[model samples]
Target: MEPVAGSLLAPLLLAGAAFSNHLTDSYGATANYWAIGLHISCWIAQFVGHGIFEGRAPALLDNLVQAFFLAPFFVWMEILFLFGYRPGLQSRIAKAVEKEVDKFHQSKLHGNGRATNGKIIRTIASLALSLAVYKYAHGDPDKQPLLTRWLHYYDSMQEDFKRKTYMNIKFVEEAGKDRHLFETAPFVGHMELKFPE
Candidate 1:
């Protein structure tokens, strides 16, 4: 248990730090869109890594969470496309909504202009979304067990990546802030696995 737990400590800490940074950095305005987008990308990446690269099934909890995160984007996209065709819906509104979508389009026509912006926006949106999910999921210590269990699943699946006994634990010193520090931990150190993957 010590070695297995140690293997997860560093990555979990790193994920917590990264998640904190993401939440704090996008706390206001249109930044939430960017944060959610980034999280969506991460979900997709993890899904691909687990299903394709790792040749394993992704944890059911993770898949459920990913679906939850994607629900907003899918609904929003549908709304945008729907309003795009409605008569007398302000042309400006349509254009603005369309602009949001332009970012998702391939660069075959414009040579990577919109795609780059879209990538940036989506990344931020994804992060913001993840922060919200984390907050909700972690809102109660009782609920945290479910998340921790999912993390355990994710970590267990990553056994192939485990290499050493030494671990670096990352933790958020502040909520919704970018302050974080990593602490070296022995295999037997006290550390909670948050986001092992």
Candidate 2:
């Protein structure tokens, strides 16, 4: 909540500094210099909070574009939570966010191979789907049914990916014994799943 509040308030303070600079004649330069210093200090503090306290890189490092727009909205949501709004869903949302952050940090500690594997799997699946779509669009009328079936299968696979929250390569070891789990599991393309002999 502190971070969220800071995110909301910092910009307004900086804007005030700018307005002050614009209003003053001789002191305008001094005001601009102080404003710039304060802005840089705030950013440095944010970085320290993320790296030292949170033990993770700030979200802005990953997505500056989205962060610019979402930060205020996120702060608003935090404000609502503080006021006891969204009582039922807020806890769930908080837990999910915490889990994701833990996973992200764990992946970082584990050398990021899991992250790369996930990306590779997604890329291959995307390529396969794109190829299927292209062939379906360009192929003969008689085989259209087969192509449509193939597309539908991939679409279902995508839906399965979306439906499951814990879809990761770590689940592959258990997926063989629990075939039903695999139905909703994320497909890691080209990874062979083997059971104990």
Candidate 3:
């Protein structure tokens, strides 16, 4: 609707602007007055249509900026859409909008619109994804449950970390020469460095 309206009106408006300098001041004022009148009439018509036909209010009432500015930008994009511009992106956007609208209506009908179970849903998705990856890498999960296999994977990760940090652990001499340094450490907390005197 917007693209069609713009395509029809834009050329005439541009032509009027181009020729306006040739017109007398009174004529230009008349044209401006006529344009304003048409705008107001169209706005009223829109309100009537929304009230009678659509059974809902215009989004202009909700957001003037979105209705006036963003709407024309979208209309321009729609005009370009006729030239096969980002068709896949447009369809994906349409699908996502449809999905969101459906979710909104469902939520409104059921109860509040508050986002519920989002964390639980994410945890379930992550667990399911990990389980699938685990099965792909290590065969059937039925043989050795997801958590059990996950624990084995976790143990290997800890082993890797321990290997990387091995330099931090003080090693005793073969005959336990520096064993005294190790024993002088507190039962808990930091140990005083026992340098050989």
Ranking by lDDT: 2, 3, 1
Query: Superposing every Cα of model 1 onto the true structure, what RMSD results?
Result: 24.8
Using lDDT as the yardstick, the better of models 1 and 3 is 3
Candidate closer to the true structure by TM-score (higher is better), 1 or 3: 3
How many pairs of residues collide in each model? Answer: 17, 0, 0
Candidate 3 per-residue lDDT, tens place, 1-197, comes to 34654676589768977775345244644554465457657766876675577434565655779889876767676776788777886787679878977876677578642433443354346446745774674465356534345555876999999986674453434336567767886689766898899
Per-residue lDDT of model 2, residues 1-197, tens digit only = 34754676678879978777465444633544565457657765775676567655566655766567677567767776898866776798799989998898787788986655555465446446756865665476654444345555776898998767456654775776598776878987897779999
lDDT of each: 0.53, 0.65, 0.62
Worst 10 residues of 3 by lDDT: 113-122
| TM-score, per-candidate, Cα-based | 0.22, 0.41, 0.41
Candidate 2, run of 10 with poorest lDDT: 143-152
The list of candidate 2 runs beyond 4 A from truth reads 1-27, 113-197
Please give the distance, in angstroms, between residue 42's alpha carbon in candidate 1 and its true position after superposition. Answer: 7.0
* Global fold similarity of model 3 (TM-score): 0.41
Whole-model lDDT, model 1? 0.53
Q: Could you tell me how far off, in angstroms, the CA of residue 97 lies in candidate 1 after the best superposition?
A: 26
Segments in model 3 whose C-alpha atoms lie over 4 Å from true places: 1-26, 100-197
